[model samples]
Target: MAQTGSTYTKCRQVGTTSYNKHMFLNSECMSAIDCAIMCKEVATCTAFTYDDLTKTCRLYQKIETINCELNKENGGITFTKETECHVNWETCGNSCYFYEGTTRRTLDEAIEYCISQGGYLAEVTDEEELDLVNSMIKGSVLLGCTLYDGYWQGRTSGQKLVFNDTMWAPNEPRGQGHKCIQIWKDHGKFDDISCLGIGDIICEKVSILRFHFIVTKASDL
Candidate 1:
């Protein structure tokens, strides 16, 4: 399977069946990487693409994204199971992760990790919980590491934004540069923070949107 830009530990080598729980438990293909296994709380598990030519399994990361004909629950596809998270986050696919890669990256790198997973920054939808999310960070150990020192200037990786469709709050960066806006309850005033400021982050599947239906890189058949 093609690695997601960065090397990870013991991910499934091949097959649509991921999450090590019941490896290949619900598969039909006899000589190929068949079936995809989703966990109990997994809301989205899209169709997996496993190429015999390349021997790579590309898992679609989305909530209710994968649409496979439900065989018997016993006919589930099990892949390499890593730590499945069930924190206070929404269900994307069969998993809900706050941080994509826990390698202590800056805001931009972390955003890349999320997009690579077919998502964006864990944008908070409400103000009340958004405030709590900010207050909750004062004493807790942060998730990502900072690449810059002083300012929260993390829109450097260049993601041209169009927030006119979004609720661009006052004092929020409307121009660009420090364009990657974040949320916080600074002094109970909901304000837009920069992505550079280290804080807990999360990513939930927005919708079942597949970017490409072809494999970019994989082993030859």
Candidate 2:
């Protein structure tokens, strides 16, 4: 209901529901956005209800079929966690990634393309992320890593490139004048290549949906 920062996605409203017995946590919040934040902080919180009039937020640990029922009153709005991400995005670990296979672009063009899709070039900070990204690529895929003035840096966040010894394949980065890095789908290793080389693009961003509830007349309920 409330839009805040752009890093994380918002929560969606599920209309007024009767779930008095399903409540597990109760706290005071200034608005539905505050309540949603509180719910996200708790790993067990699956759903929540915020009372606009009383400024109270109720969280549910688990949602069951019996816990939901249509209500005519406009006292509160229910927010539920969306299980599925948006179309064309794949859920991997805690983040969502979209791979563009239709078009190939240079390193600079790929970075711009990812930004235009509400995301940045995918950043691999750890082995798990690296493995996940490698699994998604069919062949060679462009990464966020770039060589700037002889120093490797992540183009997405400008972070220094740090990798384990095993991350780079033996005798890799063999090409001269290669400034951009790409991951091999066969071995999940990094290889420095020319920035002019066109490859598939991968975009990473938060995936969430926010929906607001609408209260109708008592007769309509």
- In terms of TM-score, the best-performing candidate is 2
Best model per lDDT: 2
Instruction: Give per-residue CA lDDT, model 1, range 114-179, as digits (tens).
Output: 677665555433343344444444322122212233333223222222223233346654434342
Off by over 4 Å in 2: 1-84, 209-221
Per-prediction TM-score to the true structure, in the order listed: 0.28, 0.54
**At residue 47, what lDDT does model 2 achieve?**
72
**Candidate 1 off by > 4 Å:** 1-43, 46-83, 86-164, 167-171, 186-221
What are the lDDT scores of the predictions, listed in order? 0.36, 0.67
